[model samples]
Target: MSQRVRGVISRAKGAPVELTEIVVPDPGPGEAVVAIQACGVCHTDLHYREGGINDDYPFLLGHEAAGVVEQVGPGVTEVAPGDFVVLNWRAVCGQCRACRRGRPWYCFATHNAVQKMTLTDGTELSPALGIGAFAEKTLVAAGQCTKVDPAARPAAVGLLGCGVMAGIGAAVNTGGVTRGDSVAVIGCGGVGDGAIAGAALVGATTIIAVDTSAEKLAIAKRFGATHTVNAAATDVVTEIQKLTGGFGADVVIEAVGRPETYKQAFYARDLAGTVVLVGVPTPDMTIELPLLDVFGRGGALKSSWYGDCLPTRDFPLLTDLYLQGRLDLDAFVTEEIRLDQVEEAFEKMHGGTVLRSVVVF
Candidate 1:
């Protein structure tokens, strides 16, 4: 039987999200239904509402979530009912070339439930990142549900589903910040701070946080940033280079997906150092770097897709770290809001105070 539940939806572009009744169908083969415990409000969700992601209207509006498995359909064996799980958008296909090449993290074909969540009027809804988690329940590919410590707080662990994971992965995985490396992170938001934390966790000798806001800079320190640079007050590349002993940081992570910031990241890294771009850029956004500089800078410039993470591998590990008081995932939960407060959360997103406004069920 289909389940009718209240959910938040973006009916059209640039319009406020509405809480409405939605129909969640029973899990089909390879699918599972999850009862959401908490979902984080992310920038991607805002992008979906503003017609930034695509022309997919009537969009289901949440993705970063943690929940419990409620039911499983035929052929679904990855998760069982009552299992505590974190929902991931990328469910890697084992048969994909990337997986067969021993890099499942770069899986080309991710999985999602074949069934559609719908509005009460029978109109189908596009689940944000293929996990419509704003509702009481959501249907997803069984592989999307990664089991973790059942004792973990849903609000904190859920963040691993997206932004935090992206940031940490940008530093640990993509940037490959090793011990004694000097790292600089641009944009001291959730993602940037996660990079800082990841750098500190791996013993980066010097971690510089660059941001326009003083408050965010201070927060970055808590995440293990040894130094702060006000990009507004100083030239980013110069400041980063000065902080890294006049050479440049060994790794520069750009969390703000803007061309200008990316250019700063490009120049802020030491020769042969990696520059990891974890920021999500709009389709219209483009960068034109001098071909000479590209040739002169003999380093890898990489984009981190979902932090180059394998959910099954990273989520549970991070959850355990959180439970052990090693990773402060709780700090990312600025406040917990109800489902009805999503619109207000979106309004405050740019206010810079809240790291994340999570909907706690």
Candidate 2:
């Protein structure tokens, strides 16, 4: 049998998201149905509505979610009904070349639900990032459900499914920040703050935050930044280097995803230091760095897709840290809103007022 639930939908580019009834089918093979408890409003959702991601109209927005497995299809045993899970986009296929090479985090063949959710008239809805949960319930690939500790609040832990996970993993996994290392994160939004928190969690002694907004910089400090640089008023590269003993940071994370910020991250790192680009940039945007500098840098320039995270590996670990109070996941939740309030939340996001306006079901 199918289930009908209220969900947020963007029927056209630049249109306001509407709370409408969506049809979710029973889980097919290798799929599961999740009863969503909370879903975080992310920039990606806004991008979808703006047609920034693609022309896939009628998008079912919202991917950062935590929920309970309501049902699992045949041949699915990874998670059963009643399991608390953080939904992920990458459901790694073990047979992919990247997985076979023993790096499942780079798995090129990830899975999503074989079936599609639809409107009441049976118009298929394109799920954002293949795992839409801006609704009371959602359907996803069984492997996309990473079971985490249920003790963590849904609004807090659900963030691990998207931007937070990207930021945290970009620092720890891609940037490889370590104890006593100096780290700098640009763009003190949710993702940047997540990177700051990750750097702190891993024992990085010096964590510098760079942002234009004083309010966001203050939030970054609360998330574990040792120093804050107001990017609008200060030269980001100079400030970062000044904070790092004039050698620049050991690892600089470019969370803003613009050419300018990327350039800042490129120049704001110490010699042989890592530069991790975790932010999503638009297609037309381009960066031109001196070829000599590219060779002279002598360190990795890596892009973190979903923080280069393996859901099974990272989600549970993050949850454990949250439950133990070692990580401040709750600090990411600025406010909670209902499903219908998502459009309003998007405006707040545009105004740079809220870190995250989560939808609690």
Candidate 3:
């Protein structure tokens, strides 16, 4: 029997999402159904509504989430019913080329639930990031459920499902930030702040945060940024360099995903320093830099996919950190609202007054 549950769905391009009934089938082989406790309203969901991600309309929007497993199908052993878990988009297929190469983080064959959730009329829904979670219940591949300590707050740890993981992984996993390394994050939003927190977790000595908003910069400081650079008031690259003893930071993370911020990140790193871009850029956006500068800089430039994370590997560890008081995951939750307030949350997202507005079931 299919479970009829309320979920948030975007029926058309630029249309406001509707909280309507969806038919969620019991998990098929290797699948699991989750009872969502909390789901975050991420910018990516808004992008999907604007037709930025694709023309896949009537999209089931929401990805970052944490919940309890309600059911599991045959062959599903990763998580059992009643287990608390964080949902992840990348359910790595071990047979994929990337997985075979021992770098499952780059897995080319990630997966979702084989059975589709549908509108009451039977129209299939495309889940955001293949893990649509803005619902009372969501179905996903069993591998998509990463078991974590249940002691952590759902609204806080659910952030690991997306932006937070992206930001933290960009620094620790991709940028290889370490003790005594100087780091600069060129955006002060959720992801950039995650990078700052990750840098602090790893003991980065000089962490500089750059942004146009003083409010965001101040928040970044709480997340472990040792210095702040107000891009609106000064040259971002110069400010980062000034904070790093006239030598640019050892690592620069571009979280804004804009050409200007990308350039700023490029120029704000020390020679041979790594540049990690965790921000999602539009296809129309492009960057142009001097060829000699590119050659002379002589450092790695890499893009972070979900912070290059291995969910099973990272989520549990990070949750432990949060529980231990070593990581301040609670700071990310700006406000908590009901399922119906997602549109209002999106509006607040534009206002930049909140880091995250989470949906609590």
Candidate 4:
């Protein structure tokens, strides 16, 4: 039987999300139905509302989430009913070339539920990032559910579904940040803070946070930044280099999608140091660098998609750390609101006020 629930949806371009009735179908083959407990309000969801991601209107917003599996379809062995899971957008197709090569994290063809969740009137809804959980219940491919410790707070660990995962994965997986390394993260938002926390967890000795806000810099320190550079007042590249014995950080992560901030990240890293861009840039956004400088840098320049994360691997490990109090996942949750308050939360996102305002069902 199909279930009816309230969900946030952007019915038109640049329109405020509506908390209206949505119809979720029974799980089809290889799919599952999740009872969402908590869902983070991410910028990606706001992007979908602004029509920034694409022209797809009538979007079911919300992706970063944690929940319990309500039901599973035939052939869905990845997760079973009653399992606590953090929803991930990447449901890797094993037949894809990247997966066949043993790099499932880079699977070229990720998937979603075979059945569509829709408006009560049967109008199809394009779910944000394929696992829209800004609702009471959501349908997803079984592979999207990564089982984590049931004891973890849904509001805190659900962040691993997107921004947090991207940030941490950018440093640990993509940039290969290691102990005794000097790492710098530009942009002190949720993603940047996540990188800072990851660096600390993995024993990066010297962590520098660069941001325009003094308040955010202070918050970054709580996440384990050894030094904070207020970009609004100082020269970011010069400051980062000065803090790293005039050499520069070993790994520089650009979390701000703006091109100017990216250039700062490029120049603020040591020669042969890695630069990881986990920021999501717009389609029209472009950057130009000196070809000679690129050759001279002699370092890896990488773009981290979903933190290059294999959710099944990283989610459980991170959740365990959160449970042990070794990881401060709780620090990311600035406030909790009901589903109807999502529109208000979107306003605060651009104001640089809160790290995350989660919707708790």
Candidate 5:
């Protein structure tokens, strides 16, 4: 049976999102319906509102979420009704070339619900990142539901479905941060802080966090940054080098998608060190680096999509760490708001007043 639920929707580009009734159809083949418990307001939701992602108007706007699996359709075996899960955007297709090569994280063919969730007027809604989870209930491919510990707070764990995971994955997976390594993370937002925490989790001895805001820098310290560089007050590159014994960091994770930060990450790493770009860059933005420097750098310059995470492997591991009090996932949740407060949450996000304002249903 179909369920009618209240959800946040962006009717058009540059318009405010509205809480409206959306009809979620029953799970189709290889799909499942989730009773969303909590969802995080991510920057991607705002991008969807601004039409920066695509021309899919009247979009169902939330993606980073955790919920209970309410039902499953045909051929679903990974999860069952009543399972608590974090919804992920990537539902890897094992047949993709990336998956064929055993790199499922780069799977070119991820899956979503074969059916659509439509408006009352019968117009189809493009779900943000294929999870449209700001609503009380959401439909997704069965593979999107990665079951985790129910004891963990839904609001906190839900964040792992997106930004938090991206940041952590950037450092551990893409940046290859290791014990005693010197790592610097540019931009101390939720994502950057996650990178710092991930570095610390892996025993990185020198963790430097660079951000324009002193408030965010303070927050970074709580997340395991050994040092903080206020970009607004000092030269980021120089400050990072100074903190690392005149040598740049071994791994520099760029969480702020601007070209300036990208360049900072490039020059702020040691010779043969990795630079991981996890921040989403705009289309008009481009970076130009000296070709000679690119050759001399002699290391990996990689971009992380969803932190290059394999949700099934990473989500459960992180949840266990969080449960053991080793990972402070709760620090990422600044406030919990109701669904109607999404716009206000977005404003707080824009003002950098909160790491994340989660919507709890």
Candidate 6:
């Protein structure tokens, strides 16, 4: 049976998200219905509202979520009703070449529910990142739901579903940050802070945070940044180099996703160091560098898709870390608001005052 629930939707490009009734159909084959408990307001949600992601209007926004399984369709064995799971956007197809090579993180054939959720008039709503959350309940592919310990707090650990995962993975998986490595993260947002925390988790001795906002930098320190560079008042590259003994950081994670910051990240790495770009970029943005510098730098430049995360492997482990109190996931939750406050959360997001404003049901 189809279920009716209240969800946040972006009806048109640049339209403010609206809280309205959405019809979520019962799970089809290989799918599941989740009763969303908490969903974080991510920049991607705002990007959908601004029409920056794509022209998929009437978008069911919100993907960073944690929920309990309410129903499962035929052939679904990954999760059962009452299981607590973190909703992942990537549902890897084992047949894909990436998966065949034992690297499902690079899975090229990720998937979502085959059936569509719709409005009262039957207009199909495109779920954000293929997991339309920000609702009382959501429908998604069974593979998109990664079960974790129910003991973990929903509002905090749910962030692992998206931005936070991207950040931490950028440092640990993509950049290969190791003990004693000097790491610098550009942006100081939720994602950047996650990178800082990841670097700290991996024993990086010098973690430098660069951002325009002093407030964000202060928060970054709490997240494990050993040093901070206020980009607004100083030259980013110069400051980063100075902090790294006039060389540069061993790994520089670019979480801002702009060409300028990308350049800073490129030049802010030590010789043969790695640069990881976890930030989402718009379609029209481009980066240009001297071909010689590309050859001269002689290091890896990588883009992190969902932090190159293997949800099934990473989610549970990260949750355990959180539960153990070693990982401060709770610090990421700046505030918890009702679903109706998502719009206000967006405004706060733009102002860069909070790390994450989670919607708690």
lDDT of 6: 0.95
Question: Can you write out model 2's per-residue Cα lDDT over 1-361, one digit (the tens) per residue?
Answer: 9999999999998989999999999999999999999999999999999999999789999999999999999999999999999999999999989999999999999989999999999999999999989988999999999999898899999999999999999999999999999999998999999999999999999999999999999989898999999988989999899899999999999999999999999999999999999988999999899999999988889999888899999999999999999998999999999999999999998799998999999
How many angstroms is residue 264 displaced in model 2 relative to the true structure, after the best TM-score fit? Answer: 0.9
Q: Tens digit of lDDT per residue, candidate 4, span 1-361?
A: 9999999999988888899999999999999999999999999999999989887779999999999999999998989999999999998898999999999999999999878999998999999999889999999999999999999999999999999999999889988998999999999999999999989989999999999999999999999999999999999999999999999999999999889999999999999999999988888899999999999988888999988999989999999999999999999999999999999999999899999999999
- The CA-based lDDT of model 1 is what? 0.94
True-structure lDDT of candidate 5: 0.95
| Alpha-carbon lDDT of model 4 | 0.94
- Which 10 consecutive residues of model 5 have the lowest summed lDDT? 344-353
**Model 6 lDDT at residue 184:** 95
Point out the worst 10-residue segment of candidate 1 by lDDT: 346-355
Alpha-carbon shift of residue 108 in model 3 (angstroms) = 0.6
lDDT value, residue 177 of candidate 6: 95
Please give the distance, in angstroms, between residue 333's alpha carbon in candidate 6 and its true position after superposition. 0.6
Q: Which stretches of candidate 1 lie over 4 Å from their true place?
A: none
Angstrom error at residue 350, model 2: 1.1
Cα lDDT tens digits, model 3, 194-295, are 999999999999999988999999999999998898999999888888888898999999999999899989988999999999999999998899999999
> Any residue pairs clashing in model 6, and if so which?
none
TM-score of candidate 5 on Cα atoms, chains taken together: 0.99
Per-residue lDDT of candidate 6, residues 232-280 (tens digit): 9999999999999999999999998899999999999999999999987
lDDT of 5 by residue, 1-361 (tens): 8889999999988888999999999998999999999999999999999999999798999999999999999999999999999999999999989999999999999999989999888999999999999999999999999999999999999999999999999999988899999999999998999999999999999999999999999999999999999999999999999999888999999999999999999999999999999999999998899999999989889999999999999999999999999999999999999999999998887789899999999
Model 2 accuracy (lDDT, Cα): 0.94
Off by over 4 Å in 3: none
Each model's lDDT comes to 0.94, 0.94, 0.95, 0.94, 0.95, 0.95
